[model samples]
Target: MKKWKRSARLVDMTRQLLDQPHRLISLSAFADRYQAAKSSISEDLAIIHETFREEGTGLLETVSGAAGGVRYLPIANRENATKLSRQLCAQLENPDRILPGGYLYLSDLLGDDRLVREIGRIWATVFSGRGADVVVTVETKGIPLAYATASHLGLPVAIVRRDSRITEGSVVTINTVSGSSKRLGSLSLARRSFPEGARVLIVDDFMKAGGTVQGMIDLMGEFRAEVIGIGIMAESQVDERLVENTVSLATVTDVDVKNRKIAVELGNLFTQGGFFDGTNPD
Candidate 1:
């Protein structure tokens, strides 16, 4: 590759490393892939690391001991975070996103590792100073995204169950309203899973009426754990206020199934224009 192309490729590699920090890769791997000498690879990394330091981003540390490798710690400024949030919200707002029960489906986006990692990183940064002890969510579908958030925060996750299973052992069940139906339903948590006084962040796939979220709060009360934060992948605007300390990546409203038209709004996660570039990327 030409010199300019090589540098651009190096920057791309650096970004990839930042996205998956704590996972190490050898210099020889990059050198071989780029068809460059080890020294050239080292020079590229030096420039990347200097950019990171100048920007106050975390280090791209090179371990010198046995089993040494490079790892990138992504420290995105507020601008980067906001940009991502706005982009995600706009994508969710597409009129064709309608699902059953007026829900805006986002399973496809959640399954995209790159996008989900960005969302998780933004959440991790927002809650970095909150001293959260764990990330919690009710499961089946939310597990993957919740896991992403938990991975970003270096925290463990506890799952709430809509239906109790014998495999979970003894449990503490709570009665609360279901998110889909207004009627009350029972949810269960495995007893002793969380110790007393745990600070938790609640996460989920979608939040319609937030009945399931309230059920989690009730369960948290039983264990005396505090709900420090809540996040959902996508939320219907009709029920945004049902939970507090919540962040939604996208918002949808005005679903007319017969007309096959739905309205979506990019959520307020980046509304303050605090972290984003202050304009739509498109």
Candidate 2:
């Protein structure tokens, strides 16, 4: 058996909690790991929890029972979240982001590892305690955001594809229509990816009219899954919105292709959600 000094043990304990968010770790387990007494372990945990709460990084939830343990919830501070949202809006307002079709380019932002991780932190914060068993997203563009959120939530990612592939082993596909152009499309999900009756949190990079988000909701129905919440990195304005109860970090109000101008603002995240101001509603 190996034992660590109190300071060394504290560092490792904090690292483990951060790395395995939402995972319950028993007091006895930590005691055994460090060859320390349960009292020592409890003190260490209290110290860590206090620091986390003060920093607004997260809080440690203590479950009481013979099988009880502590779990880390990766929640962010409202002020930090506000700063991030403002940065996203500022970055999105650049006229250079305006595309020929009046769409804004987001590849640059999505490619930034640090920015993507921070965005994932906020999504995890907003959707915390929703009883989500998995993080769901569409194929390709939404993959990164989904995985990032999953990492913070300690959940797996399930991707819905545009076309069913045989390699998926067994699949379910459904037809959907884009609310933007009224274009018809098909979405598919592997049957083995997640079990039936699972609870899911949908995460995506962008949304317009929410047709794709609607398609994903339909796909979840096939698995008898319940959608706890939806998180979008950015959502664009549309005349006919197709989905509701979505939280977004930024809102693209207008993209004038002829004038080479774009208008962006903070999304509905801070204004409306169960996690307004980064506090739990329940």
Best-matching candidate per lDDT: 2
Kindly list the per-residue Cα lDDT of model 2 for residues 1-282, writing each as its tens digit.
776999999999999999899899999999999999989989999999999988888889999899998998887788778888899899999898887677778888888888888888899987888889999999787888898899989999999999898888789999999999899999999999999999999999999999999999999999999999999999998888999989888888888888888888788876645355455432
Off by over 4 Å in 1: 1-50, 53-76, 272-282
Per-residue CA lDDT of model 1 for 23-76, tens digit only, reads 577887776677778788778888888888677444577866557768765554
Candidate 2 is scored at a TM of 0.95
lDDT of each: 0.73, 0.89
What's the CA error at residue 58 for candidate 1, in Å? 5.0
Q: List the residue pairs that clash in candidate 2.
A: none
Candidate 2 residues lying further than 4 Å off, grouped into runs, are 272-274, 277-282
Enumerate residue pairs that collide in model 1. 78-275, 79-275, 82-275, 82-276, 83-276, 93-264
The lDDT, on a scale of 0 to 1, for candidate 2 is 0.89
Going through the candidates in the order shown, the clash numbers are 6, 0
